[model samples]
Target chain A: MKQIEDANQEALRRMLAADPVLVDVLPAAQVIPELTDRMILHAGPPIDWERMCGPMQGAVMGIAVFEGWAPDLETAANMAAEGAFEFHPNHHFDAVGPMTGMTTLSQPVMIVENRTFGNRAYCTINEGLGKVMRFGGNDDEVLKRLAWLRDVLGPAMGKALGAGDGLPLKSLVARGLSMGDEMHQRNVACSGLTLRGLSPAMAETANDTHDLAEALAFVAGNDQFFLNIAMAMGKAIMDPVRGIEGSSLVTAMSRNGTDFGIRVSGTGDTWFTAPVEMPEGLYFPGFTEKDANPDMGDSTIVETIGLGGFAMGAAPAVAGFVGAGAASGAANFTRTMGEITVGENPEWTIPALDYLGVPTGIDIRLVVETGLAPSINTGIAHKEPGVGQVGAGVVRAPMGCFRQALETFAESVGVS
Target chain B: MSETKVNQFLKTPVKVVNIGLEGFAKELEQQGVTVVQVDWAPPAGGDPKLADLLSKLGT
Candidate 1:
């Protein structure tokens, strides 16, 4: 027990010590060396093309076309079905994504380097809300936006970041939490903060004023713009927590619509999986649960390091949008989550909860013992590809994965 | 006959702290009794194998 506790403490210490900085933005192929021409990186655990959900399939087809591997969605679909492309989880390549989370070679990815751990993580920039590719929109409009991001915004932001050392994310997230962003469904504050931090450099580095304005407007307009950056920061922080011997702390939790998966620090990279759950919450006008898909994304990494759902208390404004009861009741979610975690993150405290640290280090042993699943705040996509976002809400990580991980962890510790 | 302790206690404004199932707590509340429902489930969802493993790990 002491060994496990010590290992978990070490994991927590490493996580708290990590300083993830937004270093640059570059093409996925150029940065992730393993990303070959025909390869595509998606969110959640590993799965092949045949099993990908409607939104994921849609995004893949769209990315295929965007990459010039195919001329149209129909052709892309045919090529995908014919094994003309390879599919891998973004996590496999030190990255994370939201919703369908399709990351391809041509898309520019934001790079976050963990200065303390000396490792890096990557994520594609968030496309503004509505019918976008991450939610499975693959029409000509979606393709055109992807092109602009690749050609214009990505390079501009890259040059801006190049002008400076890089943007430090820890304090920005601390500020966002105070300003009512749990860094999942609500990132308005952090998005604005990100623009404020980068605008000066963007102005200094710009070759075209029109492009700079468009890029600035894009970041300012999208409230969820910081979601991808938070995700990359979460990945960078947690990657260093992996492989701590005898620890029961979760290193990652993710869903791919078909399956929800988790990895424990003790078990290394082995994934424990179960059927993914559907989110329960408010829907946009005219849409209902029937239009919603099972939850999917690598964004749950935020919860792994104790932001997102675990910090819901900090963002009372998001309560109604996510159907999480009254704003005052939001703090109860954080309190309940604390029962299943190893400790609190003192650096990221909630003002509403008397500055209590967000619950950190989800311990599988405690999850199994207490029978409480980790909660996630998420956006709901239409089950059908190309329909895009239908709603937003909260979902629970499956308990089966925790139970499986605990069992394996016990066996590994000679408890059998 | 003298009232028993159970009878005396029952007469003093019934209150309940229910765990594991909400139905019991709901029934009490419906009967005009104060009830605090605690959200809970059987450890490891009552899977014997997992419960056993948890016990082995000193749960």
Candidate 2:
């Protein structure tokens, strides 16, 4: 009991020490990696896009056109089908994308720099669920939205962010907690705060009222506009504690459209992975389990840093989408998460826990011993291609991944 | 918040939190509500008597 208590205390200290700031964000094309034509970053299992379920293939084709790699969806489809384009999971790049969080060479990304640790991570903008190319749909609407994000939204946000002295996400998350936002499904508070921070820069850059109107409306309409900032902030916080000798803490937890992976401080950069599963929850009309994609994207960073589902009690509106007894579930999830974590986040505290800090970092060893893999509440991608979002739900990281990570950590620390 | 479901937990009242409120665990303590923060961990399992205890609390 003493050992457990000591470990828990130590965990809290590490979390409280985490002070992450987002300094810069950009695209993967700017940061080079050894990516080949045969690899595409799918979030779950490796699906052969050429022979993929329709939606995945469609997304592949759409991204090709969006990248100008292919002139049209048909050509993109043929190119992927003909084995010209390779597939890889986003994890390989130290990046996380949103649902169908697809990034071509052209997609603008928020380059999150952990100012404290001097490490960086990346994630693309939220594609706002459904029939979106990131889930493998290749329709004109998907292409147009992609075009707008690339040509307008990205640049606009970039300029606004630069002008606003850069958004301080940790503070925003702290405020969001008070206003009934877990900074995941209910981002209203954070979004409002983010816009307040960035709108001045946005106003300054626009040449006309129309541009200003567009920018303001964009921020107003999208509740999840703050996700990129939160992701960057999470990257900043987690990066500080990475490579902590003798520490069994989780540094990263993310999914490419293909697999769920985690990186631990003690384990270095290796990703322990498991097959991704669908979120179980309420679905939009005409969508069901068949249409849901396995969980994808880097949003898990929110949960990893101890917000999102762990803070769900603050955002009961999300209860409609996940399951019954959401408030109780949220508190329980946060409490259970505390068992596997190193500490509570001093800055990103949760009020429902009676001002208790949010569960900060995950430890692979505890996961194995407790058989309690981290629970993530996520948006479900369409299972078949082109369907978009089917539902929202919760899932557990596979025990196998944690077991593998523990084995690797044991070998590294000579604990075995 | 359903009364039927609330009544079903005839054990110690399961505290819940909504809108930045304290959780059921803390609330039960203040009201002298017969709630204990049981070991929710698996294996040996949660408090074995909570079921009977809750039934009594309900009465």
Candidate 3:
């Protein structure tokens, strides 16, 4: 018994010690290649960000003007068309961007470095879903909002976060599960708790009454803001176990405009992919399947690590957006998901099971046997060429991808 | 029947959830309710919502 416990501890330690990064990450201009408006950086694999359809493209254009790379939308468009600037993906830079998933040179991002493994990951703030830049619309209002986020909100949160002790995202995620937040669609309580945790620091650096009030309201209004913390934490926890010999654990799952890709623990960065499809679920007013974009973005990594839609019981309200009885099904889903995983997340946990750890480290072999793929909550972009976002919903990672991953992993490990 | 009336059929204590899962049906029978789970796949071009749970259990 003691030996088994020790083995678990060692495995966990090794997982925590992998690929961690430590640094303050600013926007793309400060740390990444120049982002042109025409360059569309989709998740999973390399695709042109500019060629992306709908709200996603709009978001990229918005990021360009905010970065001062272009004086106006037309200039941004011209630069992209003429290749005046380079377009790189958020994933390539060890970062994940939200919808339209655009990260530009000047934007500030959360720089969480795993001191143990020395691997780093970055992600920008959530644009609150509706009318946000990542969804692909480049309107005047979207650009203005981007400017405010960079100039005011980003710096304020950075100072508050910097002055305080390193924010322990793992604890917040556990608390979120207890308080009706799946850490995806319904982060109302978690967002409040996060803002409250940083309140003292924010108050000290706020400088004036107006700035403080605005910052509080911004955090208060966005329910899904805690998503980035979940993403970064997931990245941190999973980075350690990558490239483990004979391990069939799935390391990362994400989607580009063209395909869905996943990396396995046994293989180093080899992506198994499948054609993308639209997520099936309830939509907002006047939006139909016709308006929804195919799966896109790295947010699904949150689910792969067992937080987002997987813990639906944590956020019952998501049923309204995804499906009825999602709370019960979500619990069953996560519970079954645990059956398919090698172990539980050490640092992050869900409070529903008297503080049971969130299921972590998806095993491809287990998924093949159980016939259950990971469930993801996602924002739907319009299917049409240039329409923005149509709605949001839940989806399952296709089983074929996992089957292929399992077969390939079995071969590599010399197993029948 | 109206949608509300149709929903009322499910509110009764002796109700059946017809989803082609025999295990669930047998379990329901153990609770003293008459449940006959059957593989009643609805024909094509039908209202899926009405046909899915009702047709399988409807005597």
Candidate 4:
């Protein structure tokens, strides 16, 4: 037990000490050397085409077409079914994405370097909400937007970021929390802060005025723009915490619509999975629970590093939007989560909780003992592919995965 | 025999604290008895094997 405790503390130290900087933006294939042609990386744990939820399948079809592997969505779908393409979880390639997280070779990916550990993590840009590929919309409109991101915004931001040393994310996230952005369902403040940091460089780096204005307007227009950066930041922070022997700290928690999976520090890359849960919250008009897909995405990585739902107390404004409850009730979610974690992140504190650090380091031992699953604030996608976002809400990580992780962890430590 | 302590206690105003399932607490509330419901479940969702492993880890 002491060994486990020590290992967990070391894991927490590495996580808290992480310096995730927005270093560059480039095509996925350019940065992730393992991403080969026709190889598509998706969100959550490893899942095959047959088992992928409608949205994920839809996104994959869209990406296949976007990559020119197929002539159309129809062809893409057929190709996917026929095994014309390879699918792997984004986590496998040191990347993460949100919703029906579809990361392909051609899509532009934000690169965040953990300067302290000299490792990097990647994530594709957030296609501004609705009828976009991340939520499984794969029509011409979606393809066009993906192309724009790949051609314009990605390079502009990459040039801006390159103009100087990359923007460090820790302080920006802290400031966002102070201004009511939880870096998950709500990232309004951080998005603005990120634009303010990059707009100047973007203006100077752009080849022309029109391109600069378009790029600036795009970042300013999309409120969840920073969510992708946050996902990459979370990935950057947590990657270093992986493989700490005897540590029970969770390194990743994600869902692929069909299944929710978690990887623990001690267990290496093995994913303990269970049937995913549907989000419970307010839906957009004309939509209801029946239209919502089970929760999905690699964005829960934010919560793994003590943001998102774990920092909900700092963003009370998100409570009503996510249907968590009245603004005052938000702090209770963070408080309940504290019991299941190994420690608190001092740098990311909630003023509402008297400057208490956000709960960090999810410990499987505590999760099993307390029977409290990690709560995630998330966007609800329609179950039918290409329908776009249905709503936003909160969902709990299934306990079955934690139980399995604990059982294996105990056995691994010779507990028999 | 005269009323036992249990009987005497039952004769007084009834107040209850309920944990786990909320049905009992709801029933008590419907009967006008004061009740405090605590949201809880059997650790590990009542999975015996997980509970055993948890105990082994000294949780």
Candidate 5:
């Protein structure tokens, strides 16, 4: 048993030691091996279109039109109803997306490689905050932006990234934490940093000056530009820790609009899920609880790797979004999360903790024992598709899932 | 600035001496982490049957 724990610790070490490099940007079909036509990769565990929440369904419809499989919204909706598409989770394919988190053959994704572990992870490029397809916005404007991302931003980024072996994301994330960006709700600083990192490459490689300027400008204007990269980094780092027999650490935590789910390291690819919880959040003007969708997205992969809410103490500005309403309360929340995690990530230090590493590995056993499920800070999408973002807030991964994982893990360890 | 000590929990065997968040401690206990309770009944005897107990429970 002690040896098992040691193995788990080693797996976690390798995960934390990962230096994910931003390698390229390409269409999902090009990067993700199994992503074929007629397949849509949504968040969390698998579900058929019939069971998908409104936002996810909406995103899928947008992608259908974007792929030219359907010419209009009405036809796309009918195609979805008729089960013309195969829906799988981003987790199933080593990919993730924010909100409804559906990735299609045409959607552009960032490719990040773990320098130490030699594995790669993918996340669709963020569609920049409002009325985007990932949140179920299937309107023309929404589809247009996604097309631009697919055509312009993706290629420019691919060239910029290929200009070097790739930028090291580990140090960038650590620096973001110190600069008051939790890499979840508040990526203002990190996005700016990304622009700085890519500008030279973009400048050097872009054939057209206007395209380079537009791409740099687009990344600069969008605060969440760093989020997809961060999620890929999280996936790149955490994927190596999955399936270590006898280890109790959580390798993944995410939600499709309908359910919140987690995968444990020792448990392999099996998911422990609970009903998605509504967030206690600050709403945008004219939007309230009713407008907010249940928690969703592969974005919580950030928390699974101990950024997001676990590093909130470093990004006090995220307090309002966290329902804490103040910097000190956010800091306390981060400290409390420490109780459920195995240890600090020595590399990803938080300034508020006086350079202490953010809480790293979430041990399902410890989470169940501590009665504290992992905390997540996330963007709240509209309950209906196409309404875009409604607000942002804090949520706890339901304790029930962790409890179930503990029971199974206990049984595996022969602890009756 | 003085050097901050590494978090002791990282080095020692897992154990939690919980003060107010007993639900947290209970989950940890269920998961095989060592948890020691602080015998607290709250400042004012907290809610009675407010099956809205999640609110009454400390976060």
Candidate 6:
């Protein structure tokens, strides 16, 4: 028992020490080996087209139109029906997306590399809030923004990063936590820091002066622009610790609106799943819980690696943002999560905990024993397609997935 | 000061004895965390009927 526990700690230590950085922006086809023509990568566990929920179906059609595989949504829907494309989960290819978590072949994606481990992960560029394709926006306006990102912003970012790898993401995240950004639902500080890093680079990009300024302003205007980078950074760090035999740490936890799934370190890519639950928290003025879809997206990678919601105590404002009600409630949730994690992250301390390190390293065993679930702050998409974001809130990982993983662990160790 | 806790629990082996909810024990078991749950009930001496019988049979 002691040996197993030690092994788990060792793996977690490596994860904690990993340095993930945003190195470049590139077309998905150039960087992601698995993003082949007619194949779309999505979030959570794999699912077939027939079983897809409304928002996912909508996003697929939107991605198809953006890829020019189909001229319009109508054609895209028909193409999917005729099996003109292949569907797969992003986790299979070391990539993740938020909401419908859509990634198509031609889309531009952020490439984050783990400086310490040399592993990489990818995520689509943030569309900067409302009516974006990630939330199933298929209008001409959404497609136009994607084109601008691909042609102008992406090239400028790549130039800014240069051949010399980008800024160390962990350092930025550490500073962000201290400055009241949790790197999840609230990323005001991290975004500001990122823009500051890229401002000089934007000044040098070859794009027309007006276009370049607009591009810089686009990122500057969108607060969540840094979130996709942060999520990719998380993936780059955590993917390296995957499949460490007998190590019961949770390497990934994600939801597909239809289901919530998790991968355990000891289980080697095996996913334990349960039906996703609706998030509980504040909603947009015109929406309510009933209009909100089940929790979805790969953004939980932030919490999976001990940022975002795990550092909630550091960003009390995020509690009200995600429905935790108040700063004290967020603080309590953060402390509870600590009970189930392996240890505190020395680098990212929460002020509410007397500047205690934010809880890090989720151990499957600890979660099951403590009956505590990791709280994730996430955007809530509407159940219907094309409606875009309805709200943002906090949600607990389903206990059932943990239960199933525990059963598997018990059987594997011959303890049951 | 808080940085020192990066591996607080990992430095020690685990042995958790839960006194109430089995759910907590179940959760721990999944992660391979060591947990021992006590199936607790009220003491028998607290029951008036049982207490009276014990008193009547006392030496």
Query: Which portions of model 4 show Cα errors greater than 4 Å?
Result: B1-38
Residue pairs in candidate 5 whose N, alpha carbon or C atoms collide under 3 angstroms: A368-B27, A368-B28, A369-B27, A369-B28, A369-B29, A370-B24, A370-B27, A370-B28, A371-B24
Clashes of 5: 9
Better of 1 and 2 by TM-score: 1
lDDT of 5 by residue, B1-59 (tens): 22344564466678779987679989998999998998554322343322122222222
Off by over 4 Å in 3: A1-25, A29-42, A49-51, A70-85, A324-326, A346-351, A384-387, B1-59
Candidate 6 residue pairs that clash: A364-B31, A365-B31, A368-B27, A368-B28, A369-B27, A369-B28, A406-B30
Best by TM-score: 1
lDDT of 5: 0.83
TM for candidate 2 is 0.80
TM-score of chain A of 6: 0.97
Instruction: Provide DockQ values for all models, in the order shown.
Output: 0.57, 0.05, 0.03, 0.57, 0.03, 0.02
Per-residue accuracy of model 3 over A265-358 as CA lDDT, tens digit each: 7766778888776787777789888777888888777876677766765666676677645455656656766766667765556666656666
- Per-prediction CA RMSD (Å): 1.9, 9.3, 9.7, 2.6, 9.7, 11.7
Q: Write the per-residue lDDT of candidate 1 for residues A308-364, one digit (tens) a residue.
A: 999999999898999989999999889989999988988899998899999999989
lDDT (Cα, tens digit) per residue for candidate 4, span B1-59: 45798798878999999987899999999999999999888777787877787777764
Error of 3 at A362 (Å): 0.5
TM-score of each model, in listed order: 0.96, 0.80, 0.79, 0.94, 0.88, 0.87
Off by over 4 Å in 5: B1-59
The Cα error of candidate 2 at residue B40, in Å, is: 6.4
| Residue range with the least summed lDDT across 10 consecutive positions in model 1 chain A | A407-416
- In order of TM-score, best first, we have 1, 4, 5, 6, 2, 3
What stretches of model 1 exceed 4 Å from their correct place? Answer: B1-14
Scored by Cα lDDT, where does model 3 land?
A: 0.66
If you score just chain A, what TM-score does every candidate get? 0.99, 0.88, 0.87, 0.99, 0.98, 0.97
CA displacement after TM-score superposition, residue A295 of candidate 2 (Å) = 2.3
